[model samples]
Target chain A: MSGITRDTLMAFVDGHLDPTGRTEVEAFLAANPEVAAEVALLQRQNDAIRTLYAPAGAEPIPVRLSVDRIAHSGRRRNNRFLTQAAAAVVLVGVGLAGGWLLRGNADTPGIADRLIADAVSAHTVYVLEKRHAVEVGGDEEEHLSSWLSNRLQTNLAMPDLTASGLTFLGGRLLPAPDVPGGKAAQLMYEDANGERLTLYITPRPGIDAPRTELASLGADTALFWSDDMLTCTITAPYSADKLEAIASAVFAQLNPSGDGYEI
Target chain B: MADILHEIEDAVPALRRYARALTRDVDRADDLVQDCLERAISRRRLFRPTGQVRPWLFTILVNLYRNSLRGQRRSGDTIDLSSIPEPAVPPAQPGHLALAELARAIDTLPPEQKEALLLVTLEGLAYKEAADILAIPLGTLMSRLGRARATLKTLTGAPAEPHLRTVK
Candidate 1:
């Protein structure tokens, strides 16, 4: 008989031995009851460990741990960090713009800045309102879409952000002192975590403005994008990439004529 | 890249099981798995297409688990094992190891031994794979497993090693 060392016995118990080696170990065990008993004891120890912890593998995984979700969020976070770095550079420019504001340009804060500030302020006020968060609830989808479209005069579609995990809470009308129509649509959304997002959209500012702008206000981020017809500033406490993702979805539905805003 | 994501997804359940055994807490285990997934997903470029995703993921998880323990130690946080929920299985029959007792005994094992034992026993990983994941030599892995089983036997009050019976 071959010398079946302690490691061999363990290999046997762990089922790591080859077929020939397994047969040899079985024969050895038959000849030696003491070693067989020891093997049985180790086997039971393994079985006990499996019984204690193996069920966790069989349980349903939570949504937050979904691989697709993790992968999506990871990619988004990288983009957001880059955007934040870019936003920092933009902040330096805002500092220059601030210099302009200090020099008697205060009353005429740029339309983009005015719109972002208003979006953030509206978001802060209404997100805390439990009973009256929106003038129209999301349940009235068709009416809400048409009413906001007619009010904004830009064929606005209630962007369905459900795909991005944001629920459309509803829409309301607010005054836009800087836009031609003097009317803006404030649409609110809530995510599964109860955090609120508001989109303040107005007719095109009728003045030359950068096609896109991003601002960080305390814990919130406001992103503004404009085409020839409408301008939208989305304000939320989410990171830039998350807002960017939602913005893409929002633009797809709101425009529907072409691909959503690029970059 | 897409292929790697699918491979990583397939390994999540086993990663979760090992993490659960290591942490003995569902929330903490899931949190560990999440962190592992995020790291693996982000650093996927480093993964070789020819390599197996399971062991790569297990290696990441084991390293993360060790790092977390280090952080906990530095922060002076002690895990209150009693606060963790007990195993859901029924009590063991007579002569079987009392599973709860065995679990506590397993918890008493040094992290290296616990990791090696579970990777082999519960995870049913190949000895070579477990050794690689633990970053230990095969011989060292065997000795750790031996020491772990011996300690568990004594802790759970199992019988002493049997002596050979002489043939007539």
Candidate 2:
């Protein structure tokens, strides 16, 4: 407190000073700003470390690190071990009555999961383009709509969402290997800020999974919905509520009959 | 308790960032985090004295990192220094050397000094808690921090405050 040493200067830099000590150091720095500049440099080094790595905190946590999932899996493992031990006891006592029932097959990959993954992968791939973003530009809306509709084997109309701040850029036909028809259409839209969103539409005639399911992948949020004729997935970097509102506008114009468009 | 698990979950991102900055390899940093999480979950029942999970989690992560370094030192596995890309320094910065140059300077610090510097500067840990995490005395922590700052100054070639001194 009384004597200013190298340690005191560092303590000041690290914010280790008590209030009175801080005042003392402040006075010292005010007089000897050469040393103050040194302190500032150390502080800048701290800023550099944070600048380099702090974004990792904002980046979405990978699915493996999900807290709820990890805890649930841990409990499931414990329950499985208990079940096996009970089966062992059953073999010792009840003579293998239901040992075969524990052998269920591995679950099949859900169709909605595949659709969302494909939609996001496709969105991630083509959204970065400056000139080649879409197969048909928005300048030729009638022809682009007909071409995509003809290719997708469904009646496809471009959803105009200018009121929602997203302008139609264009559409591109993409390979949707997960769907029965094996084809999908991507309609690109960009807001005034140049943030892009894509609507992935495929002919999912019979695939029904609650009509709407939302999933988060990295920085993108995907909302997938299906009607009796076509399945539409809207993927964007916007919030879930924003995307939902946009999707509502999209679905209303997408299906003329408008059966399942409100939700 | 589920609350404790939630707290540890909340700390995961910061832990990952700190680990990434320390190791500078994505896979290695994530593997370290996974191991740290698993150990904390298993041994948490033993350290629930005050329910202070943040420092405890940091303690486990720091120890695991040190042990890994010790093992790597014995094994003689080479880290290709050229592989770590330097961050781009935007030209509009006001008064500093290139930020990438500062990054490489930080990389050159001794392991102990680097740990002290990061825990204080990067992680914003209190000096006492940081010392506790490192299992070093408070004075030792200060010395390590002092040495780290000195080395960074030398490597960064920080410009002198000619104007301020002239005013003085």
Candidate 3:
């Protein structure tokens, strides 16, 4: 560090020198004329270069540089890789906070994604329970609906999926760590051959996400949609078409009077 | 998530300034900046949570510019320097160099040298940050800057004497 070299001088001229180093270089320049002139020449060059280009930094930035718009484009591109089947029905929900973190925004692993993952994890864990699959079995329909509705703080009426060739097995209250409510209601259903599906419902009070998207997570196909009051993730090992059909029915019974699930 | 976008937004103007100097053409410069923004935003998860965004963005822009140059050359595209009329400038005063001649001299430097020089001088980046963006060692960046300045001094017809003669 004691040696005075050309790089050191250049660093001094460019303000890259630290204080102690600057003093040493200053003393070195005082004892040297040619080296001092070279440093002055370098400083002049820097000034000329700034004069030629710094104005561009002050120019008004183009609208095309909008960060949100660019992030959206990335999400749109990200969606192309989502191999699952259902249409991305816009479910623009209550507030834009959690919902705004949806779709192609998956790469950053947002809160909504964590919710969907938690749904899938819960589904995988409980669907295998033999004697105690649900805390309050589906046998007590009125009790299950009332208890889960109270727990999730949402007006959740079990969808009458009996018309969809499935029986309402039961429902349970689960922890939804990523959502605002901190609780989710999971309803279990099974076809005649015992094919199981779980609907993970959480009251997204401020989640302005009004989107219906189908994503294939491992062996399960998850159809995620949210309206102003509630957000639901339907995860099943069924084909995409089968999930879409069940999702339509669930959406219908979930919100019969309000915003019809848009495709 | 919006925080990352905010950081990227803060870097846009500086990125455009660097691109403009590098390309010496407005449309091309803006095009480069646009490409840089799209790539940065689309893959922002790669951004470190506590890290600064300005150097990361410059790294992306420099890589894209290099790749574009490679693609253009593969197809035999060439830049016609003569058509880029040097901007009008007043005569050089005693110690001053002609600004237009200096600009042309800059245009004539090899891309690597020009990039190193401008990053330090024009963009005012610290040497380490400039080197990191260029993906080169600090010594290599210093050498490039040294050579670029010498070339500019010669091409601008600035007198070459009295340059670092005191030390052997």
Q: Write the per-residue lDDT of candidate 2 for residues A117-140, one digit (tens) a residue.
A: 567667876888889999889999
* Residue A83 accuracy (lDDT) in model 1: 42
lDDT of each: 0.79, 0.73, 0.75
Report the Cα lDDT for residue A25, model 1: 87
Please provide, for model 3 over A122-197, each residue's C-alpha lDDT reduced to its tens digit, 9 standing for 90 to 100.
7777888877778887789899999888988878899878887888889888877677768999999988988789
Runs with alpha carbons beyond 4 Å of true place in candidate 3: A73-263, B46-50, B85-95, B162-168
By DockQ, the better pick of 2 and 3 is 3
How would you class the docking of model 1?
acceptable
Worst 10 residues of 3 chain B by lDDT: B42-51
* Candidate 2 runs further than 4 Å off: A74-263, B49-51, B88-94, B159-168
Which candidate, 1 or 3, has the higher lDDT? 1
User: Cα miss at A92, model 3 (Å)?
Assistant: 34
Of 2 and 3, the candidate ahead on lDDT is: 3
Every model's TM-score: 0.58, 0.53, 0.56
lDDT of 1 by residue, A1-263 (tens): 55687788889889999999999989989998887887888888888888889889999999978989976652323233324333433464433333333353335556777677566656766888999999999999899989988988888888888898999899899877778988999999999999999999999999977566666665777778788888898889887656766776777676766533121
